[model samples]
Target: MTTHHPTQTTTVQTIFRFLLGGALILAGTSHLTWARTEFLAQVPQWVPLNGDLVVVLSGIVEILLGLSLIFLARQRVLVGWVVATFFVLVFPGNIAQYLNHTDAFGLNSDLARGIRLLFQPVLVAWALWSTGAWAAWRRNK
Candidate 1:
């Protein structure tokens, strides 16, 4: 919890927040379009719902979350938590992909899949930091 000048914090967070929003929008769009197969690779076999359905639903959720992240600054902290929870909720798919050695999104080998495993936390942290959700939690705690 290193502190920065409020101006710096606000500026940096704004940039990251926008970037994350745009990324989510793109990802969500892809889920319903050309990258549908790529996203399907991340859906674990254990899920009772059809993998395509899961991808579609998750994509819609991503779009909504991304839109909220960009447009709802007043509720950014709560949106951030929801976004982080989304990442957490989907992490099992990532793990299953790695364990099952499924290739998609150019992750062709164990090394690549393993590396991707590391980024999930980064996304969770990004959702938190870019929206001050972590700080809010800290304050409440």
Candidate 2:
């Protein structure tokens, strides 16, 4: 008897997933090193943790998430959900930067910061779409 297996993803999805993974890796590295100060500017001042400490910890988390995105295809759906959640969680920091008028990463003006805010949802969608998480969830439902 012969058996057929189901395909999990399309070529385009795989390409986008890898691209997202690579981007995440680069962003995470910057968070830890060269862009550390810029990342601090995004932290909400009211956050109890020291800004530097928060940046360092979040950088570590980003690195791990990037690695998971790249090497954990079998678990991509789970990773996607986690990554999307992370993006949502950090959104308040982005808002705080805009509301507080903090300048960092060249987002000096309100227009620049406002434009940046629009990309967060895109990133969340990218995580779900690239990993087929959205499709998988719908399929289960």
- The true-versus-predicted C-alpha distance at residue 139 of model 2, in Å, is 0.7
lDDT of 2 by residue, 1-141 (tens): 943222277779888888888888888899999999999999998999999999999888888898998899989999999999999999999999999999999999999999999999999999999988988887778
* Candidate 2 TM-score, true structure as reference: 0.94
Q: In model 2, which residue pairs have backbone atoms overlapping below 3 Å?
A: none
- lDDT for 42 (candidate 1): 95
lDDT of 1 at 86: 95
Score residue 68 of candidate 1 by CA lDDT. Answer: 93
Query: Candidate 1: where are CA atoms >4 Å away?
Result: 1-9
Task: Judge candidate 2 at residue 96 and give its lDDT.
Answer: 96
